[model samples]
Target chain A: MRKLLPYPILSLSLLVLWLLLQQSLAIGQILLGAVIAVLAARAFAALEPQQPRARKLGSIFKLAALVIVDVMRSNLAVASIVLRDRHRQQTAGFVVMPLTLRDRSGLAILACIITATPGSAWLEYDSVRGTVLIHVLDLVDEATWVDTIKNRYERLLLEIFQ
Target chain B: MSEVPVWVAALVGGLSILGAAFTLLGCIGLARFNSFYARVHAPTLGTSLGSIAILLASAIYFTVSAQRPAVHEVLILVFISITTPVTLMLLARAALYRDRAESSGDVPLQWGEDIVVERADAPSEG
Candidate 1:
């Protein structure tokens, strides 16, 4: 079993992806998908990527829910800023915030979250300084951004990843 | 497609229009924003909820019309959500590097200068 399915979760996801893409569930398609999934999983295992362990399933769900709500709220806020607040003075600037979550997967997820939201962009991460540079579209208070990232996302990410 | 219920049709229509409007606004923001970093954030409006809304509409339309689950659109959603950030991050980093090399005052100078000092001090702290 270990030899055939080195990465069980990866193989399962690949199989599901194949089935979804094919939009079929015939026995023949299932057999073919299984073959491809195993082969693909083996290939991926050869890459030796760092495996991320998600320790808290509940935290993961919580993070997803929080991200969705925040994204929706920011979508409206940014839309207003773009449409109605054009005349007002907007302070758009870069924010440098320190982060404690060091897991590569967590950092990657954080980058995705920051960039996916309408108002913020992940510019750079300084590994040596353990800090990230973010660009805010409507920068009101830098401390608020820092607090949001640290308290809301980073803490949950640490719980799940670390 | 023709036999879709009124509510389903309304929902799909509303979602499609919302998605298109958001995408259009994102493009407008892209063009209107003054700076590179600010402009980088514009398309995310389209990529995030815009794409999701459109994909959801497609899924619902197909599912209702065909009388079967047509959730393959979710693959597109997952792919877009994962890939957009990577491309945007790369673009932002490349822009930052170019701006720094040119000594453009638009971005913070500390990014370029502070890395060296931090790296030099790392051994002593350890």
Candidate 2:
């Protein structure tokens, strides 16, 4: 089984993706997708990427829900800022914050969360200093932004990935 | 199809309109924002909720009209949610690198350097 499927979860997800793209569950399509999935998994294994150990399914779900809610709220906030406060003096600036979540996958997920939400963009990460730079569209309070990232996202990500 | 229920039709119409409005707002933000860093945030409005809303509408419309679950729209959502951040991060980093190369005082000095550009609108330190 290990020889046939080096990465079971990756192969399974790839198979599901293939079936979804094909939009069919016929035997022939299943066979073809299975073959492709195994082959793709093998190809990925050859690359020898670092395997990320993600745990705490409950935390993952909570993080996902929080991200969705935050994204929607920021969408409205940014839209109103752009439309209503266009004339007002907006304080847009870069925020520098230190992060304790050292796991690579955790950092990547954090980057995605920061960038996907409107009004904030992840700019850079300094690995040596364990700090990240993010640009906020509405920079009302730098400490608040830092607190949000550390408490809201990083804490959950640490729980899951670390 | 014409046989779609009134509620379904209404839901789809509302979702599409909401998505389009959000996308339009994002475009307006892109044009209105002064700096590159700020402009980088504008399109996220379209990519995040805007794309999800439209994709949800498409999924629902197809599911109802075909009488089968048409959830392939979710694949698009997953792909968009994953790819948008990568592209946006790259763009933002590239812009920052260019600004730094030109010695623009708008951005910070370097990764570890703590020289923040002070602006009139910056909140005063307590």
Candidate 3:
């Protein structure tokens, strides 16, 4: 079964996405989508990358919800700043944070979380030292940002991926 | 689909224009940012706020016009939110590699001297 659908999940998802975008389930379209998916999956197989180990599925979903809410909140906050006429305040600055996430996937997830948040960006990371530099568009409180990143996202990611 | 109202169409058009403008702003920021350390902030603005505006417009318009919940567009937003930083980290690692190889000024690279980098063109590399 696995050999028959060598990239079972990928092929299924690609076909679904194709249908969603085209909003059609015609026989010809399904066949074309299937062919493209299979080809893509074959190309993917050449890489032979390590599969992501998701240890805790429930925690991952919860973390996803948390991230979404935070993203939306920050988006509104950022959009308001862009729309505002205040030229007096300069809201951008750089920050350095000490990190505990030594795992590659965990760190990757942290980087994504920081970058996904509107006010912050993942800059440079020193792997040996386990410290990451970031720039914030709206620098409010440095300690707060540090705490938020460390507690909110990093801990969950460590549990899920590490 | 019923006869589409002009106001809703205009709103969608406006939101789309805003989204595109934000995306352009992000690209400009990416270009203009001085250091790799500073440059990472630019694209996040585009991906977060810029894409949100576009996705919201999509969800709103589709739900209204098609008369159904158009929640699946959230997946794109999720994908971007999760992937952008990962790519940025990889790029930063690559940049750090090149910089350290050239022995550039103050790169904050603490990766140790186990890997030796020959200085062939010192003046140009830095």
User: Highest lDDT, which number?
Assistant: 2
B1-126: candidate 3 lDDT, tens digit per residue: 465578878788788888888777666656754556545556776887788889978887887788777767877876886677777667766776687889884565444464434344455856
Q: Candidate 2's residue-wise lDDT over B16-97, tens digit each?
A: 9999999999999999988888899999999988998999999999999999999999999999999999999999999889
In the order shown, the candidates' DockQ scores are: 0.68, 0.70, 0.31
| lDDT scores of the candidates, listed in order | 0.90, 0.91, 0.74
* Residue-wise C-alpha lDDT for candidate 2, range A1-162, written one tens digit per residue: 888899999999999999999999999999999999999999998998999999999999999999999999999999988896665636899899999999998999999999999999999999998999999999999999999889999999999987
* Residues A1-162 of candidate 1: C-alpha lDDT, one tens digit per residue: 898899999899999999999999999999999999999999998998888888989999999999999988888777777785555625789998999989999999999999988899999998987999999988888899899889999999999999
Docking class of 1: medium
Candidate 2 stretches with Cα past 4 Å from truth are B112-126
lDDT for A83 (candidate 3) = 53
At residue A143, what lDDT does model 1 achieve? 94
Which candidate would rank higher by DockQ, 1 or 2? 2
Of candidate 2 chain A, the 10-residue stretch with the lowest lDDT total is A81-90
For every candidate, give the share of true A-B contacts it also has: 0.68, 0.92, 0.43
Question: How far in Å is the alpha carbon of B57 misplaced in model 3?
Answer: 2.3
lDDT of 3 by residue, A1-162 (tens): 655467888898888777766666799899999988888887887888667777989889989899888976876665555554546226567678999888787777777777777667776778877888876777788999889889898888889887
